[model samples]
Target: MASPKRPIRIAGCSGAATDRRDAMRALAANCPNDPIDVIIGDWMSEANMTSRAASKTDNVGEAYEPTFLEALEPALPHIAKHGIKIAVNAGASDTELLHSVVTKMVASKGLKLKVAWISGDEVLPAVREAQKANASTFENIRTGEVLNSWKFEPIYAQAYLGGLGIASAFLRGADIVVCGRVSDASPVIGAAYWWHNWQRSNLDELANAFVAGHLIECSNYVCGGNFTGFKALETKGWENIGYPIAEISSSGGVVITKNKNSGGEVSVQTCSSQLLYEIQGPWYFNSDVTAILDELWFEQLSTDRVALRGVKSDLPPPTTKIGITAKGGYQAEMHWFLCGLDIDAKARMMETQIRLLLRPHAHRFTKLAFTKNGSAPDDPTNQNAATVDFRVFAQAPKEEDLMPQRFLRPCIDPIMQGYPGATPHLDWRQALPKPVYEYYVTLLPQADVQHKVHLASGETFAIPPPPQTKTYPAQQPCQAVTRGPADGGKWGRTVTGPLGWIVHARSGDKGSNCNVGFWVRHREEWDWLRTLLSVEKVQELLADEYAGKKIDRFELPNLHAVHFLLHDHLDRGVSCSSTYDFLGKNVAEFLRARHVQLPVRFLDRGRL
Candidate 1:
């Protein structure tokens, strides 16, 4: 270990469900010679957990993500040799099975690696009992739908666990710590807590740890990957992107960096982009701490290093978010593209023909939707611009009702006779009906959910509950502004152009809500942005998706960004959403493509 005065260097190898990318080998190949104290891998995702739950029911032994072992296969020997500690949340639903498999792998390799796993995120039994008893605590957060009213019974429910259990495992000297359903940032927080011996009430220090965890949680996300300003950064060797490493000191200050010889570049823009990824508003809440992002600022120390400061922390909320997955019936879609002129008319004709054909069988489906994916040709530059994808989606109670080929027979068989310039872009494999998982997100009191750490010695201990009990409102939005930017700027005239001319954007999903954050580099542009892009203006920009939805807008003056969260816009979150852009990644780009009138001074700079 480095001197006590030196910061603890922790490297994050894998982001959520990135096992297929061979993240372990990257870590093994890139472990700095200076020695990394801890390594973290984020493997669990909402989809992964739901799938793991189903897998466990099929076979008791196969509960965790098997790719996790595949990821660690190449790096285990190197890690053992270096005595480097590992804390990962790769145990999606079955941490015990993960521990068993890992210990066996360690023994087979003839290495002395102690392993521990943590549990207690599973709450299916308690939730089912409460639902059967007609408890009022299981109501859906958005729709006000009670648990008993659900069409299909939930297969599994897991509450987001905190980092205390992971911290406990590390404190007890476990070489490898595996956990199930912990929050994405928990492994980082747990490792930091153990390293610094932080107390529960150390909100300021814990807040810094939380910031570091959130920054590096997605691995390469803070290292220029998926960044909106990627083109502006040094792009050599981008194919071999470097992962994030946080050097967190005892005082909670962090310097985020990656391997010097590695690919991706780390800068203030990259860090800020990741910081705004999935956050709802200025206050980012976690199970461990609630960080206020209103005053957060990032400073670039060097090319591959950045520092974050001014973020304040408060006690965590009384409850933790819980995700419940239920069978949402079978869904199928038939895709056909309309080419050349009269795209709308062709799409309308297709919808009419398909609706008339399926009208007789309408009662069999819970939902039947016709969507025109693209619009008419604007001058026709490319084949894609002149073509529009007309799709018909159907969901039914019985799988047979959505038997893909059979259900889409009417649409496909009559395509030749229906409209001119119509063709399909998919093959037989894509025409099959797929199972949908209806995701319900709500909160459960942290006190009711128990967290336990199973030690390598076969003994377990219960983790303590959060110290504070605070309640956040169901919906919180910043005050709306009714003013415009100062008109005089070098006394130049205004010009109308795409919002992307002076704005950069990043968007992501939090449950069913979609957040899009827009930023401008110049202070002059920011002044115009804050007043130009109000909640109503944003609603206008994303008019189609924002229809009949509540939108909350917040301003980040330091980053020159405006963020808006569209409530219930993603249907029922990513898994069950019928929208083509399920994860809301395109929402920001879509908004940036919208035309807007802006000051000529900013546009003249050619910084678009």
Candidate 2:
């Protein structure tokens, strides 16, 4: 039986640009502590993206958007030390571009290059492609109409490349990795399984890594910063914030924690709060499986760690595939703040005054406003001071020019007409207009993404070659009489992993989700592999394997594929959900679980 206990470990790097020296200082801070296996640094920000793009620091050549390189520069050297492999998506427009700089840096320092570049994810063009693929079923997520019918073009289009490509790169020997436009959660996932060279089809393994990714994806949240209601921390010594880490196992378990001696509480509530933050929906995707949420559960580990498990796969749900944000058109506003004895009266006065002021301006305003949030219980018993503010605007072709000075007439009259002393309030101003772009993330089919890891600048190095290739296990090609539906006649192929080669045969309709996929296994381990399938060797696969699941199986004559419903295997059943979070998976245990006993003798290839 699996132990209920979990590990206490957390990992992260301080890459925030409060100061350049802070990177090294953050690095030095980690130096004194016992080392954890992983270090996650979250250095990208959407706000930073806009700001960097404005400064041309992102250097996309169009003089816009922040480049991954600019942001990573301050943090790279500190990462390189301690020999911790770094994962970051600072590649900006060019995924390949950052590798050159890294390779050069390694060469300059006489350090081995452990760099992997993951790519094939720029989704801007995909909007059109997705629109075309979906038959215009996708509207800009907000707008009721189809996007293809419109003339508006986005400034940038990029997909949230999950961790796969980068993880694959780590297998290629990258000490420092860079990515572009990958969702923030992906790097942590990439780090967990990439170095180990995990099989892509290991759903549970993928689930664990994906969960780990989610925890550290948001920097301080997993640490003490976002975790509220915790007991006293040495706030005086809390100048540096703790970064999160995960001690993951191969079977898909995650233990979340932070640096030791770091002041913060890690508990179920804190962990739960982090899990639910900012998620617009129940699903989050990694490269291999789209994890289902309903299968996930979490429990606190030690003081600083929390464990998660029971993650499973699920079908992508039906929803609008396009993202839409508001267009910043011309508009109008009023700005005022009130303070007086009766906070309620002060607020009411401000409200009535603004309403009266906007009587005529309302027609001219595109979006007029007075929002009362934050303060609750308007007629408060506290009798505390209260202040109300108002901002209204007049629409125009351009937001900046909307209403100009001509709209100030009403604002200027507060001195003589309203309150005698309030007449001085006429010297107020309107709220500034700013563009509010819409944001959205869609579930594009896996087929839409074509991943590639192009290895270049291959100068031979003094670094010891990983292991003897002779002992490296080779995958045995399935001597199958057939492979179904793959346009290519290539029925059998050998893929490499940390242990050795796995020869996999292609098949179709593996599940009833109306989709097709492939499975692979080690060539020499056919006996073991055969036992895993519903094929001839296993007698008949059990429905209980699906945990009380059911589904129809079909074989497509055109494809020569035998497809069966996994039942609840990964959400083939209508009752299951999509979305899997990580809690515990020891890097070792997760991999070992897959190496089950079988009739055939297993072989070891090389040291990972």
Candidate 3:
């Protein structure tokens, strides 16, 4: 009989472009007991790509993430000494430029490391050609709006790539691999594929790694960074929160853990929080494979170690997600504080005054909103505590329309005549107009992308599309019962309090859509949760934010969770959104804070 092969350990350091810069060095140098075989990081996102496209259009900044270089510089010596391979998608738009810069850095250090870069994710030319042939080919995935109906001119387009290219570079004797806009989990998937030498037909194994990738892709997320139970980590302190590490066996079993002696934790609850983040539904799709998330489960194996099991797979879809960035317009804002009693009347009076002042130039503005941030407490202790902000936001197609004289003058014209205690913010620069970039997400044929890898050995080759593909419905059938909650008599007693008293949640954005997943810690609470939190219940709780928005709800019985996807809730997406919660990170917390009738049986255990 053959013996079981040893598992490969992969460490994740960065979650986004602006993540902690010293994480790479800390992971490389601080992990003594858990030596990693490879290091993978994700640096690209829809909002980031939009900003990069705008920068490139104006000829102002580099087209790639500069922080990647800063992160790699301090860890290069450790990486070379331990011979740990590295893969990252930090080369946002200009992979060739980043590749050349990294090569020079490696040589300048007198290091003989081989660096390779993968490109062809950028498809601006292909998108233009396709639009000329048939605009419907690039129709919006969310709204079904054809490309021809788009008001803004697209400046750049990039398709999400799979991990085969990264694996090919590793096979070609590359020590480091850099990529542009590959799917966030591609780096982890590629490392596992190269380490196991698995074939494309290994769908189950690939799916396991895919889920593992999703869990750790956000770095410290699975280690309690965004967890609702974060107060539990007070003993260790959050200053040095640990990054996640995935240990995958040859057969595709995965154990998620973090660096020893680091802050934060690796428990079933923490891992479950990351699993439910930013996901659309039960079927989690990537270019390489689709993971069926309904049946997946997590178990605590030991302290700071959780095992993932029961992951199933299906063939990937023939289409991949593509993001196009365009100049939306220009935006400006101003804030005024309303203090003490009658806050509602004060806000209404200010709104009426601002509208009348700008009534003549309303045609020039595309969007105008008067937003009230918070409500004052009935009996506040101090002046600061009694004040609430009333903000004015304006958007226009022309820069001059949003300038200080044109936009700010009308807003400030009603100061003396404004309600009493109305205090405008002292900062004049807050009213200056800034360029807005809109991010449009759509589907692109996989064959349209020329996915390729340039090896360090002076050889280059193309990566063909997946051998097998399957088509999935726009929405999967709900697997859990959605009937109303059972009679209150069975629960013995009930209490009214914050929903967070017995539930935990994680929420994020998918383009303009906001998805929030709520779960319970105990199995007994799952039944009450699934029945109590239905689509109508969610709408009732979030009436102000998503009352009229189209919402899709799904259940994950294995995780004791329910998810809600609110369509077009972000206004246009992060780069162009005018809402304070632009990225939708607070949607979960917002729902959690809403008062609800909670069963005392579940509350007896304790709050999250």
Candidate 4:
């Protein structure tokens, strides 16, 4: 069932919130008079996935992003015209449901598709099975704690089922491969490698296809939405975002481009930024075959096309990345306030009054803050009466715990305190905090992890075992925390524990492969931070913000500040990580349960 050996094409979209189907249809129609056999649409982020799942539970489809379904609506008609098959990860959390919707819609018109509806990657069902079997809750390899289920929210629930899954679906005579969620690059890699019959020995060749997939993975980020030059533009369209496409060659080289006469502009800078998104630093590790982008180059094929070349393979690492999802408890928040005229002055007065009001038990509160409606810039220039606000952070294991206190602490502000300049709203209490637990998960990089390529009819597509890197805990410390080895260049500094002051510094091109972040203190000051945020804690907050959405994976192990990999968290054959979905078992939490301490330490200032 394999096709010709020509290169495959793919694209990343550039609009703010464009439909995936629209972009895909445009892609098929605008394809450069070339024979394109496959197309991929990456539609879910970790947070978005969570949102999708939650919305489904609530029976309200209005809240979820409709790009995938909408895009499929029009795209199916267009692709059906030429028999161009497509594989996309845009079904949100309900792959079966998404498939049903697409199928019913297409069938309504008396059209039938040899469509393959697929599912099985989110760990929610696995969790139920494991718990039923009295199985061990897979732990995060980093920390040594069992997950608290209540706190877990699903961000994305895709399986890292390899390209073969989709190809096999296509080979079974299916026209479209509908996946709940898969790896970000696997779709492109699957489309290209499967068609060309590129096997495992062709790992290097597959690497080329993967690189092309990676390029267009970040949507408009690689084109112009995030262009830093700012002024160099004949035009820029943030509204009519352009989706990317890779005219991939079976030989591993590709021409990255977008739809014809698109709204956004493409250039070297845009594409370069995308090339750095969510990829492993040493190189992107794929089934032990590392696609080395360290020495990669991009050529301007035209106004919208870019050529990628010079990607070499690296010796594979020994550790297989263990994907584990575990239970964490739930967590929720409320923005209760204490406001008044001279609102800023009133807020400061209350902090003093409350500290005195609580008279010594003030420390009982977990989190309490007073500011100009937000965290610090401490800017005198931003002073405004209406712009002031205060926030309190609280938590408990139950909802009633918050219900009693809903009005317990809020209304007391207006009645208990006095501000000469204040007099307006009578409602100081809006709502109370509702408690939800957290799901703690982790990804473990270990040996013996299996990544199989499943053929369409349930056969195995064997791959030549690519190389992988394996290292002990170094008996020292991980550079991401303690100082890195002074190779004279790529070392990092991390800050931990309490300090008298705090400052935030972010470096590296946000568009670069590695966006570096660090904390700084004066040379004269002792290494102290007034407050320190654990990289994991920050990710938790990020998760909270993106509650119920599929999110990108964040690698805190290498970066000084635990840089976040923007987008590109879905694809095939890559480990179908379930960290983003509501995990009864989270891999990060799973690993820690095994009592394994990968690495954690104080920052070393030796190189500084």
Instruction: For each candidate, give its TM-score against the true structure.
Output: 0.94, 0.61, 0.97, 0.64
Query: How much is 204 displaced in model 1, in angstroms?
Result: 0.8
Whole-model Cα lDDT of every candidate shown, in order: 0.80, 0.45, 0.87, 0.47
Model 2 residue 322 CA deviation (Å) reads 6.4
lDDT, ranked from best to worst: 3, 1, 4, 2
Stretches of candidate 4 off by over 4 Å are 1-5, 13-21, 28-37, 51-67, 123-159, 230-234, 287-289, 314-347, 351-389, 404-412, 415-439, 443-608
Q: Kindly list the per-residue Cα lDDT of model 2 for residues 387-504, writing each as its tens digit.
A: 4343433444355344434355555455354432242224434344434332332344445555555554453222111121111111111222233322222323433332212221
Best model per TM-score: 3
Which structure among the candidates has the greatest lDDT? Answer: 3
Question: How accurate locally is residue 133 in candidate 2, as Cα lDDT from 0 to 100?
Answer: 72
Candidate 3 lDDT over residue span 1-608, tens digit each:
11238788999999999899898887777646569888999888887788787776677789888889999988888788777889999998888888999989988898888999998888889898887888446778777687878898999998889898988888778889999999888988898888888888988988999999999999999999999998888886687789999998889999999977789999999999999899888888888999999888899999999999878999999889999999988999999999999998999999999898888877899999999998789899998899999999999998988888778988888999999977899896869999888888888878888999998777889999998899888766553347565555777789999999999999999888899999998877888888888888998899777649678888888889898888888888898888999989999999999998898988889887
lDDT of 4 by residue, 1-608 (tens): 44366556555532222433466667666555644567776775444544555555567674335666666666666677767787777655666666666677778766666566554445554444544676655543223344334334433323344454565566567677766546566677777766776665676777777777766665655655544332344346665656677787767777887666666766655665465444434356543245766466667777887887678765444433323322122222333243333556666665565445443333444333333344333345543523444543333344444443442344244434644443323343334543231223333232222233332344543332234353434111112222222231222343332221122222121111122222232321112211223334334433523333222222222112223331222211111221222211122222112221111222332211
Q: Across residues 1-608, which tens digit of lDDT does each residue of candidate 1 receive?
A: 23546677788888877533566665655566545778888887767776777677557557887777887777888888777788888888788889999999988999888899998899887677666676646778756677677777788889888888888998887889998888888888888888888888888877888888888888888987877666665555777777888988888898899865778888887888888888888877778888888788788898788998888988899888888887778888878988888877887888888777776677798888888887866688888778877888888877888775447776687767778876876664555778777778877778768789998899999986797756877766574552455554543688778898788888887668888888887777778888788888987888666667778888888887788888887777777778888888889889888988777778778755
Show the lowest summed lDDT stretch of 10 residues, model 4.
566-575
Between candidates 2 and 3, which one is better according to TM-score? 3
Candidate 1, which ten residues in sequence have the lowest lDDT sum?
Answer: 482-491
TM-score computed on alpha carbons, candidate 4: 0.64
